[model samples]
Target: MSSEHFDVVVVGAGLSGIGAGYHLQTLCPDRSYVILEGRAQLGGTWDLFRYPGIRSDSDMYTLGYSFKPWTQAKAIADGPAILDYVTQTARENGIDRHIRYRQHVKSAAWSTDEARWTVQAEGPDGPVSYTCSFLFMCSGYYNYAAGHTPEFAGAADFGGRIVHPQHWPSDLDYAGKRVVVIGSGATAVTLVPELAKSAAHVTMLQRSPTYVVSRPSEDRFANWLRAKLPAKAAYGITRWKNVLFSMFFFNLARRKPEKVKERLLAMVRVHLGPDYDVGTHFTPRYNPWDQRLCLVPDADLFDALKSGAAEVVTDRIAHFTPGGILLEGGRELAADVVVTATGLELQLLSDVAFEVDGVPVDLASTYNYKGMMYSGVPNLAHSFGYTNASWTLKADLTCFYVCRLLNTLQKRGLRQTTPRIGAEALKPQPFLDFTSGYVTRAMEKFPKQGHRWPWKLYQNYAQDLVTLKYGSVDIEMEFSNPVPTHAQKRATADA
Candidate 1:
């Protein structure tokens, strides 16, 4: 029944939470905060998912934080490397001490009377409470403990071991074995080539296709800088350069779909051949950047397909059999193992319900303030990464904005902050406005963005550098509620 409190309580000790803690400490050195990590370790996505061939889908140069330089030899970093980088950032910045590992936040409810969030959590020891003025959720959408495994007609009937890449079993070996990877997203694509390296045969099963483009492991200038310049400085420069490049390409593909289509098709034509039906197998019927583009590491995947080590089956998986999976088209793909690389399942707002004055807030009916902030939700800001450019680009911006809001709170004697965007800012969120399953799933719950190119999570560092990073926090923020007293009983006590 004991309880403690902090100025801020951040859920998820991943890159986003770390960044938030770091910025908060920097902006308000006097303030104290605690980071609650569900796992025993720090890094969220980076530390989790130990599947084979785990690597950054995006280039590391931009994926890394803005303040902390990515001093890695490879621009496209693997999971372990990314995990190490985040751990090092935590340690070097002295943020590790603020993190409480294995503290699984089950739910968080806000108290309008006290102006504090009652975070209820369950750990190895059982239920606990931690109250804070500000609650920042940096947990990435996908549920780590469980990934999506669409109920196949007979998944239990599968005699052979089946695994989802999001939760790959380490003891399960696939060397010299036939493996079938289901789904066509990044997970399936990466698993196809990676398993083929060891497995006797690997087949990528998908209902539809994505425009997969091969990229060099290292760009020429990026390589030159790594060899010639100081590590941190070179990393910063390369990070910005890659960020700009990514923004350019993403905008190019979105604005001029035909150009990207031609470029993408040409690559596929050279590899798959004219008779292979690039329109069906290679081309995405939707425009480029419609969904998050899948990155192919240095044509490794293409080379694997070409080497005859792997094959792609463009048909929906019907069900699971004892031995393998059967496609809806009556094509039964037999294998020793089946890896469900299907899409991720997203949970918004940390599955926490919000209420103002005891009235439950239906997020589906509510509007998103900024890409991160929600309306009337005081002392709360969610982390949103970039679909284009790097994930950290938007993460860093959100962190910066949080810090700015904090400074404003102190200056103006404000107790709570929430975006007051009314009917004027009902535009779609940039990059996200596009039709992506992840975005579409949470559109109603998330904030409304402007139609303008950069304001919509458009990945424009130059624009965000001005708006979010440096924009003034000159708005109406409520400073109600007196500080809690000893006689004050715990309100909704439990993370």
Candidate 2:
């Protein structure tokens, strides 16, 4: 049988993969590569998540690519807008031609003899294999098709609509109906506010509390600059400005809790008034940024609360009954709809089972290399974006590093490159130290950070910029492959 081959193969056609594809093309204009998208269409996360009020939680500049400046006036773009942006990038660079939609790569195996990966793929048509010298996994950590739902004691029998944000029903009708949004993190916070505008009354139920901060969707300073300066310059400045502001507040919230909390409460007091239960509802027990800060789009959520559209009920869910969910205080939330914006199922290296020569490689046992590469994986890099800065910052660096490695391989005639991270070096960091429900739920499966400083994700943009973008971390990569030879000729010569 003939073998399909390419210089490189990128999994996932989202921002990271597209960026990787673009970089690869730029590095080798004539080199051939293929981008395999599991989804029927491009735009992995953005396209997959179609929940209400979907938007980028982070600022645009850093979240967006540096090469292609985000020209949108409002830097915090909606999910659809972000999707459009990525798709446009794909189209502009003529990257769509290289993308094979509906192609899911099941497993990849490295051959020491061939110095390449034989990727087993499944598409709509049938099973096909591709031999690529390099493999880039950008499938992301979250399971796109579904979210994690805890086993509620009596949840199975409850007849009311039970929906996870990951698998939101497009035809869901919440108009004039009672709604309940479970979980305290970003998704629940975002979901409740939007659903409340039309629903009879939206109740946000949580096991614990979260810090909810409100800001205008469009910043006045940004608006003022947008009016005065060129869009590009304005966007760049706005991006940095927001980045600094976020860092200041986030770090302040982390380091100096009292001062930050005082200010946070003061702002909440001004919005909700002194009569409201600030301690019970507004204030979180945990340190700020310990969990993700809940972003209220344009302060609309508070506005919704002020207008009596939405309300908060901070209570532990006892169990679910057929008609409603029972709380700890013996109160029942007779919800017409229940949205479990609980969390995602994190699958490190996207649950891809790999083997070397016949030995099965365990993903759980493997340590992450610089939070991007796996210790045992050779010539492979995963797109784990910046949790602190704009996601694109890390992605850009990863792409840059991949390009560097590829260029070096071509020059040195190297076929495979794998890092050398030993067990002793991988003792320090875990994926995250947060008590957040989601991270806790998926802790056992995710990759832990190594003892090496930069190898662990510090979640700081400036730090990563220096390390991944500029640091010299490239190690040994052997360049050799086996070729068919005439054995009879060798024997005759030997004789």
Candidate 3:
């Protein structure tokens, strides 16, 4: 079959991909594009995760796209509701038609002479190829096929069912059964309270403590604004309000770690009361924002604890016995079901091999350009969001910048644009500065960031809004008009 060609090709059909498509259509109408999704669905994370009580950690006002307003009453929406929003956005914007599901991009090769990417993918009918002027990777940062689960001793000896939240069984029954969730992150915080509703007792077994906070399920300010203002206006106002609040709190936590830690623990004490041993279970060794603080809507986790339906046990797992898990102190907790809400395995560029003129691209050796593009990579952009704020806050800005770059290229008649790192004495740092286990584990696999401007990845949205949205792309970027020679055509034909 002849290879299909387009002006642009998007790697995933998730939130970022759909937003990129919308921006491409609205900003650069002349350009043609298609979204290639590995899975046979539009919702990427929302569709893949089906564990109990899966919801967004970030508020929906900022998580929602700037172009579209999220009019839902609950800001912390469930998985199904968020999925509906994503699919609905795709349908309303006519982006769903451009999506080719189950097209897993295996590799992408960029030719300097042609100034285009030859993408190879595996589909149902077998191999397929496509050429595009630009490639946008929105595949997210984690492995879709698997999650991080540690090897526990005697895992096979357990008589009860054990499940990872990444691939939760749909048919498994847990009503009135003892459930133990093994984790302390956002996933575990969400699952414990939710599973306690039906389970006879639910226990959160964590090796260490994590910072948890509680917020209202519905945004009263946003609701009030919506009542008074127009839909778009209300959304914009609430979006900015949340953006500023997030930035302020993040800065405060960084500036005054001790004070912030005290305040956070104080809030926990208010929720769990003084009688409960908050020091043993709620106190973390690190300060606030070291890792992301888990959010429980309306103190639901605390409510569950108060009602005596759920409990937290901070101890190391010695082994899994036939009845349940045995802690290091010889204490055993009986459970009928064990849900491992561990962490995600970070995957950069969806693990798709990249080549530049037949030479394999070494991503680790390169530097991140403005947190969007990569050094020496031509006509390619990847969307990675802010660690401290809502993901879409950065995603929207990145998409806008990509659109701007594309428009400029079209106007200037440029075939390719690549970031060329200057010879400056700069120290290389990990891509993400967070102390989360997943980020720390995958540091070496990701590209390093520089200490200076443009080369540095700023987690601050305010700075990024100015740089990515309004900044010029000419600095540190090389624009060129590539023309294929007769020798190059001969070499291509021979190959």
Global lDDT of model 2:
0.79
Measured with C-alpha atoms, the lDDT of residue 67 in candidate 2 is 71
Write out the backbone clash pairs for model 2: 217-298, 414-479
lDDT of 1 by residue, 51-163 (tens): 88888888877788878877655777788999999999999999999999888888677776587788888888899899888888898766677777777898889888888
Question: Residue 455, candidate 3: how far off, in angstroms?
Answer: 1.0
lDDT of 2 by residue, 1-495 (tens): 355899889999988889988888987776689999888999888899999988887767778876777777666689999999999999999999999888888889887666778888887988878888888898887777678988777888687898998888989999998889988787887888789878999988887777887776666787788789987787778777877776777778778988877787788778887788878887888777777777776776677778888988889889998887999899999888899878888776667778765577776666677667766667788888865556787788788877877776777766767766643555746776677777788778876676566446677766766776677656322334344246744766799
Worst lDDT run of 10 residues, candidate 3, spans 421-430
Candidate number of the best lDDT: 3
> In candidate 3, residue 222 scores what lDDT?
96
Output the better candidate (1/3) by lDDT.
3
lDDT pick, better of 1 and 2? 2
Candidate 3 RMSD computed on C-alpha atoms after optimal superposition onto the true structure = 1.7
**Candidate 1: 10-residue stretch with minimal lDDT:** 449-458
